[model samples]
Target: MTRARRKPMVAPKLFSEIDRYDEANSARLGLICIQERIPSGYTRWDREYNLDGRDARLTCISPGEYGGVPHGLDGDFATLLNVLYLEQGSPESGEVHTTAYQLIQRAGFPDSGQYYQSLQESLDRLKGATYTASESWRDHRQKRWTTVKFNIIEQIDSDTEGGTAFGVGTTLKIRLARPVVQSLRERYVKPLDLTFVMSLKRSLTRSLYRMLDAHRYDPANPQEPAAALRLPLLQWARECKLVEEVPARVRRNLESAHAELIDRGYLKSVTYEGRRAETIIVYEFGDLPATAPAPEPMIEVVPDSPVTEALRRRGVAHPVARRLVADFGENHVTVRLETFEAMIAAGYKARNPSALLVDVIKDQEGKYAALGTSALPAAVAPHARISKVVGDEDVDALSATLDTEFRALPPAEQAARAVTSVRMFIGKELREGHYRSLLRAVQAGDVDALELQREATRAAAELRLPEFAEGLRRAYSEP
Candidate 1:
């Protein structure tokens, strides 16, 4: 028998400090400033590859490359830059380009190829509404060459793009290295778990180290009898001060094994239901400052209209009336009615009858007012009839409905201006009787009902509704 020679495994290149920076910034791939210049000639304009290929005319800067830019948030620009490098090639291909990839690679990343691929996919997914390129030359008479610059508004992926949860805290940029991913694979994570983890990994891990450090446990004492160290590191980290907050669902799962954490000296005490429950026996690891609570945003409530003099004659509580004035705006009796309803919903149980009466003023100057829900017609009706009787013009009705519903919620002051800007949303068609009914239903938690009111007002014309639509979308969006 002959002995077989064994092959030695090659050592992996060490991950670089720059790799850490890239991961932290979510800019692992690199960034590029693409400048394309083409003399007007027989350059093949591949309409098949563009968004509006055939319909699009070829200029000095043609539309051959539409889906080839980096997008998805600010830091993701690095990834976008990386993708452009891979797809478009270099000046060797006769296309002008500049990149920071070579600089990044010099920093030492074993998995630079994967990082490059992430960049490529991100850029390839880009689609643009319009593509414009400028043609200019510094010395036009001498060189006779075009210095072209293309301007693109790339599409953004909201999910993968990093976002702040509390809106007050610093954003976490997640870029999991190949090593970390491998480690995760070796643990309880399975193939199905890989899919699940990939979906959540971006948000759950990015820049979490500092937070994890905050909550790290000391090994001195064991609080629970069944402590084991094989548990998830994040579970222990959450128990420590490193990550002060976990999603509600995750916290629930931790409760069952919390005692085990204590037994392993990974936790000292867990707070629950207004009391501290000691689970871990040890406290020697030293204490961390409690996580700072996120500050509540300030709100400025203002009435849309002036109050009637008759109401002033009755002498309502000056502070309470002023509060209403500030919250509901000056000219809007409709807003005033809505504000009162909001106060009631917020647990002001001793209802004020006077507030309701003051809310339904006839407007001495003859500005139209919305009839309360009690006054709505009993059956389906045309827009013309509704407008004649109640003055519910499409635009006016849209504004009034949005104001009444959105103002009642605790939204930021900036949101108020944004919400009432839309003519109508596509979601207004679901309600049956009246727009007011849909508004009230929204307050009462009938989400589908609210969409119906919005659908009823969808217009066929171009609209000045983007800002309002954004606010409305945020308002109804699930947290």
Candidate 2:
């Protein structure tokens, strides 16, 4: 007899304190590693600040072993938090037992080798990491910042006895530290869109997105549909884990990451104000538009046409084909059909042809350009306008390398080149906005243009794009 196929398991939604809009866990959480790559060995961070007239101290210790602290709490760790919290029925619960496959599925990760590997890594980091916070009130409560210590996960008990394919049976018994559990039990968590969080490509962008999303205006309160967060440059830098002491470098790094958030539609706009001693950054949250209802299916039966036949042959539904022909003129339909056929011939898969065709018609010219193709008439040479040039993919790859390259430059040269590299990589509109924001930071005495320029020259040499780098250098060097 054939063995019964195991039914697929469904994971539940994950939650976190950072998911909500609250000041408590706002500045000092050591949960995310803001760097591009995990640093080797244990990393420790400590800071002291005054919030709402109360003095506070925050300290985080990331163990060297177990892959260091997590890159951020959004992706895998967020999923793990959800799984553990849900299993215990309360965040304050000390310990719980579960299997690796259960956590992976619950976290919404694929049951694959790579995902399992990542799950193990997150578990290791969580078990080893620790956080502490101390606060003293100004109203005669305490003079110095008092401290309380806690671990994210106090301990992990693993069992790998039942051998299964891909190590799926590895069981984990986890104990969450009391302080973290209490914070969660007290409703210090924010509700977030896990799908949107996962969609963000960069960790910094993801963290910033969550912060802004937490501050989004509640629809129930018509008087205030949105909220604005004003963060001082130094504090912002500390919170973002961008730089330790330099405000100018912090501004440069923030503006670059902010551009990505704006492009992804997570932010509406970012403004900056320079003061004599500090720069202030203002973040504005945009309203997420309600998704429009699907269009009514087309009912008309059109006359026999090549476009209709072509669409039908390509598995486009009859109603969708009719709608395309009716909505878009015959010529537009014909061109898109040809392009779609070309893409198919070139091994491109149109997973949702109906939606893809709609997008294709809407941005016809840009779509062709984006696809690295030219829309030429059948009479003209088809490959005439298909010139060899750098594509977006190449630019994206270069952009990632640019950060590492910029960091390698001398400290004096880093700020300026960082700004220049951002301008070159992002779109024209976004670049302009970023420059304006930087100028605000500069005028407020938060950043120095001369320093930025000095760094740009060194960065240019490193990039080996002297012309482009020098052009930017000159622009900054000039009045």
Candidate 3:
């Protein structure tokens, strides 16, 4: 007699599938994810490299207020900007429309109101960062080197008011920087395997994978991805923006990322050659036993892990499963799985079973807090989460970063950029008339653009989601 297949002991997930994203030009800079952690009190970074036989330099300045230079989640948000740009029909520049909740879900962040605050924080940082490329900025369209300075994101407009959190459907408009557009128009890009990239837990691994992609994958023959990559150790460290330049320390820094990538099959082996800074790190891609498949549109290039398999069994997509497991730990995820299954056994019907499962795992806003049949250990409590306040500093930090960058721009460009901001006042809020006139001075190149952008940028971030409003109120109620 044939036995029935085992029922999946998990609930279904509800999320729209995001296609693979096209990323261009980031590979050339390779400074976005230099170090996993930016050193405290660090606000400026400068590095010199040779480009096309000419000396070039990259300098990034971040105000100490806006969480230092655009590091960590800043880079991830940059990648997501690319993804969202492509997802929102074809715009390499100009505005791509989206909502905050959609960004969180598509980026595989847990569905929670608290994340809405973090989302805005990352967005603010991206806009706050100023990158100066002295002859290092590759004009891909012109096929020559050029000097330029710009923020990661050009502009932001959102349906926000009253310095509060936004709701799920709050619309947002984000414009891409010109250099990014030029690269895309010139086809200096590759389809990033986000499925694989997002699966890797640490940002270091993700950064390494992207940088290596730049080294291994050629856009001309995008199908034939190279299987090997070799680079000098200390040079690679510099390229990665590692805080510590010492060889041993660099290796120690990359130890975990290297291990994760190898375990995930992005690399079969990573071996070093020679001595000191000149030591060459060689990477062999894929598994020895299995021949690697040609790069696909959304190629994962990874074997299924047990946690991923478990999540997949519950109807979560492969990439999403890995992302969820990576975002939340595997150890406690299994418990979430069991809790979800228990709900199913108890006849708790769900419109989106997988979403319910994830919500249970995330203990999103304590919605499923009381559903626990048995209380988990303090270390394993799913509902337990740290609620970090979006303090005054977080709100006020980027004003300096935005102000300094605007002032640094030449009069002509600054006026042009300001006019762009002024045009956004077309059909906004109650302050449309008053604010439009205020920023119109900047648009006319009369007054400073700092005050207007500072307020506008802060407004964009201020829309607190209804779920977290009470918590925010309580926090602000203190002192």
Q: lDDT winner among the candidates?
A: 3
Mind giving the per-residue lDDT tens digits that candidate 1 earns over 1-479? 32322222222111110011111111111111111122223222211111112221212222334333222221233333322222221111111122223212221222243443443343332222122212211121242212232222232211111231211111111222222122222211101111111122122221121122222212111011121123233333332212123435345534444443333333455443221232322222112223542121111122223453333333332223443444444544434344334433444332223432342322211112333333322221111232444355653765666657544533221121122112123223222223223233343454443243333223111121344345445544433
Considering lDDT, which of the candidate structures 1 and 2 is the better prediction for this target? 2
- Model 3, span 371-407: residue lDDT tens: 2223333332332221122223432454345556667
The CA lDDT at 295 in model 1 is 23
Q: Which consecutive 10 residues in model 2 have the weakest lDDT in total?
A: 12-21
The Cα local distance difference test for each model comes to 0.27, 0.48, 0.58
Whichever of 1 and 2 has more TM-score, that candidate is: 2
**Given candidate 1, what's the lDDT at residue 240?**
26
C-alpha-based local distance difference test score of model 2? 0.48
By summed lDDT, the worst window of 10 consecutive residues in model 1 runs over: 16-25
| Best-to-worst lDDT order | 3, 2, 1
Kindly list the per-residue Cα lDDT of model 2 for residues 1-479, writing each as its tens digit. Answer: 22322323222122221121221232124345554454565367666776557777776677776666555543345445543453233423345445666665555455566766777676667666676677621111222334567666688755442343224535455776665454444333334445555555555666666545543433122112243578787776665544344866666665666887676655678988986347888887543333532221122223647777676565443434554676666776776555545544544433334334444444322324233222333332222232223345653465456545645543323333334333432214233334545534444457654455334333321222334434444454422
What TM-score would each prediction reach against the true structure? 0.16, 0.46, 0.56
C-alpha lDDT of residue 436 in model 1? 29
Please identify model 1 stretches exceeding 4 Å from their true place: 1-201, 205-335, 338-479
